[model samples]
Target: MLELNFIRANKSRVIQGLKIKNFSEEDLQIVEEILSLDDTRKEVQTELDSLLAERNQLSKTIGDLMKAGKRAEAESQRERVGQLKEQAAKLEDSLKDTKVQLEELLLKVPNIPHESVPPGATPEDNEVYKAWASPLPELSSDALPHWELAQKYNIFDLELGVKLTGSGFPVYRGKGAKLERALISFFLDEATRAGFEEVIPPLMVNEDTARATGQLPDKEGQMYYVERDNLYLIPTAEVPVTNIYRDVILDAADFPVKMTAYTPCFRREAGSYGAHVRGLNRVHQFDKVEIVVLQHPDKSYETLQEMLAHVSGLLDKLELPYRILRLCGGDMSFTSALTFDFEVFSAAQKRWLEVSSVSNFETYQSNRMKLRFRDGKATRLAHTLNGSALALARVVAALLENNQTPEGIVIPKVLRDYTGFELLN
Candidate 1:
């Protein structure tokens, strides 16, 4: 949510940002509507304040009149006070209603894009922030895609997953299961070494938690809801992990609060179909290691770079060929002020698959979460950032497809210790 004062002061800029974000002309009118509602709120508040002050003065006069033995005069003042009370009550209700309307409109407005964000409307318009300069690994004609490789090695079974759950769910078997565990351990260890505190948050969160992280009204359709309990299955560890600081206020000294978690994310990819969604390309449930940061506003962009470097280092260790893309305004998430996505080359599949997305929300989330830090005499919203150190499904797909050999699928050296005997055969 945007600070109301900011919107009031920078209405034109807010509208411009929304336009760049692909908001239609109809949606753009919301800004004007919000301002109008705010006007009503202020008018109601001023009237209520004046009315209360007048009533207080009249009640004091009534007491003085009664003490003076002027019973009739005091009774007249009492009647006037009763009328003022009724008027004040009505004004108070009007003020409350206006505030509710203001808040509802504010919630509909998305975070403004940073000035540096490119103006575009789709993924194709995103800039290639970093290109993969090295030669992409080439696979032989006989080389198999990850799904075929999985079958050859008895790695994971989509059919078994269908029997147990549904399509889009894959059950790992043998070395595939081991690989998943090894990747989780490897990512967690890497994060801890980089000074991030590891946390194991609950997989389900209440509606307040969901809304605090900007996942409720925006991406609610993608989440799995436990209707009876009113809980949502987390779509990403970012949702729960970042909410840890919800409603928290910290000292300025806590400039960078870093935390990480590994979780199984659940997303309902409704209406998704075709060859692009094959095997692990898209799934309802997937394991991922997420890194979240709450930073002082001035240092947030700097922290974002550090996070990008950390994720890049992981990919380097895994020896995956990858490139980073700076997402255009429309391609970015509703909560992200700026985002960079990492795509790894899948040799057998002959494509680039997104494996991670690092973003700096720049108070977009902190505002909604009420996460703040004290700066001198004033409190300010902190900037929140999060990234997939690596989402395992696509990483595994890239690993299996890119590492295929006449012998077997070779595990990256960084994960060998975790997997014990790594070469999946």
Candidate 2:
């Protein structure tokens, strides 16, 4: 959400920024109209308040004049008070309507972009910030995809899972289960080493948490809801972990607050279909290690880059072939001014799977959370950033798909110490 005053002051510049995000000029014109309503609201409120004050003073004067038996003066004051009451009441309604109009418009405006965000139109517009040295792996013509490989190795039971629950719930078995555990531990360990405090938060969160993280109003369709509890399953760790500081006032000393959590994120993934949803690409429940930071507004972009570095380190350690993409305006999420996606090459699946999204939301989430700190007599919302340290299923699929050699599927060296097995065979 944008401040009304800022919108009023920077209407043209803000509109240009919105254009870069692919927002229509007509939608921006509507915002400008809303700004006009805001001005009207403030003006009416000022007038109504002044009238009320005058009416109160007149009432007091009328009382004193009546006590002194000055009938003429008391009568004149009483008449003015009656007219003033009618005027104030009418203006009050006008003020209320103007405020309502302003609020509705304010909520409609999206977050502004950071200076570092590249101006572009679609996913193709995103710049590649980094790519690992590892080359894409080659497999034989009979090479089974990750889904087939899962069955060949007896690692994943998708049919059994769907029978027990539904599609997108695949059960891991034996070493596959252990491999999942190893991935979780490895991600958590790496995040910890990068100065992130570990947290174990509830899977379900209240509506406020959802709203604060910019998930409620627009993402209700995308989340799993527990009606009896009136809570929604978190789409990402970013929802619960970031809400930790909701309505909080922190000290400046807590700057660059880094935290990580391992969670089974549940997404409804409604309407997803075709080749993209095939195999390990889309699932109802997935594990991810998320990294979040609350930093000084001026340093949030820097912190976002730091988070990107941490994710890059994990990918390099895992030796997964991957690329970084900067999401253009059309692809950016509602609350984010900018976002970068990390896609790992799934060799067996023969595609790039989105493994992580690192974003700098700036004050977007913090302002909604009411998360602020006092810095040199200035109190303002802290900037927020988050990224996936690693999303397990996709990376696991990538590892299985890419590391498959004629001998067996070779495990990456970094994970060998943890999984206790070099190959799935």
Candidate 3:
């Protein structure tokens, strides 16, 4: 959610940014509509203030008239006061309605992309910020994709998952289950070593929690909702972990508040059907280790670079051939001001799998969450940032496909200690 004052001041810039994000001309008109509604709100507020002041003065006068033995004048003043009260009540209702309308419209407006964001409308338009310079892994002609490999090795069973719950939910067995646990542990250890405090948050959140993180009304359809409880299954650990600071105020000393968590994310990948969605390429439930930061506005972008480095380090340790892409405006998330996606090459599948996305939301989420830090005498919204240290499904898929030999799949050396004997045969 954008600060109304910012939008009022930068109307043209906001419109241009929205246009880059592929907003239609019809949607661009929302900016003008918002301004008009704001004008009405100000007028209504001014009238309400004046009316209350007048009523207060008249009430005092009525007391004075009664004390001076002027009963008729006091009675007349009382009648006028009653009429003013009725008008005030009507104005209050109107003011409340206008505010509701204003908020609804504001929610519809997405965060404006940063000035550096490229103007484009699709994934193909995204710039390859960092290309893989090293040679990609090569597999033999008979190399099997992760799905076939899983069946041969008894790693995970998608068919059994359908019988248990539904598609996109795979049941890991034996070594596959152990490998998943190892990856989670490895990511968590890496995050903590880099000064991030680890947290275990609930997988489900209430409406306020969802809205505070910009998930409501925008990506609502992608979330799994529990109507009976009015709660939502979180799509990422970022939701619950970031909400920890919602409605909070902090000190300047806490410039970069960092935290991390591992969560089983739930997403409704509706209408997704293709050869690309095979195996662990896409799933309804998947494990991810997320890192979140709350930083001073001036240092937020700096913090973003640090986050990117951290994710890159993780991929490097895993020995995966990967590249980074600076997402184009239209390919970015609703709340992200800027984003960089990391893709690892799956040798057998012969495709790039997106395994992580690091983003700096600036004050987009902080404004909605009312998360702030005290700066001298005033409070300012904190910048919010989060990224998948690594989403395990694709990473696992890439690992199995790239490391497969006639004997077994070789686990990365860094995970050997965690996985014990990690030759998943």
lDDT of 2 at 421: 94
- Cα-lDDT of candidate 2: 0.86
Write one digit per residue (lDDT tens) for candidate 1, span 1-425. Answer: 88888889999999999998999999999999999999999999999999999999999999899899999999999999999999999999999999988888888888898888899999999999999998999988999999999999999999899999998899999889999999999999999999999999999999999999899888999999999999999999999999999999999998689999999999998998789889899999999999999998899999999999999999999999999999999999888889999999999899999999999988888888999999889999999999999899999999999999889999999999999986889
User: Each candidate: how many clashes?
Assistant: 0, 0, 0
Q: Provide TM-scores for the models.
A: 0.95, 0.89, 0.96
Report residue 196 deviation for candidate 3 (angstroms).
Answer: 0.5
RMSD values for the candidates in order, in angstroms, are: 2.1, 3.2, 1.8
Q: Which one wins on TM-score?
A: 3
For model 1 the TM-score comes to 0.95
Clash-forming residue pairs, model 3:
none
The most accurate candidate by lDDT is 3
Candidate 2 lDDT over residue span 1-425, tens digit each: 66666677888778877877778767778776887787788789899999999998998898899899999989988888999999999998888888777766766778877565677777778777666465677777888788888887877887888899998887999888888999999999999988999999999999999998889787899999999989999989999999999998888888989999999999999888677787678999989999999998888878888888889899989988899988777678878977889999887677888999999888888887899999889888888899998899899899888877777778889888889999887
Global lDDT scores for all candidate models = 0.93, 0.86, 0.95
Clashing pairs in 1: none
Candidate 1 segments whose C-alpha is farther than 4 A from its true place: 54-78
Tens digit of lDDT per residue, candidate 3, span 1-425? 99999999999999999998999999999999999999999999999999999999999999999999999999999999999999999999999999999999999888899888898989999999999998888899999999999999999999999999999999999999999999999999999999999999999999999999999989999999999999999999999999999999999998789999999999998998899999999999999999999999999899999999999999999999999999999999998999999999999989999999999998899999999999999999999999999999999999999999999999999999988976989
Candidate 2 segments exceeding 4 Å error? 51-97, 132-134
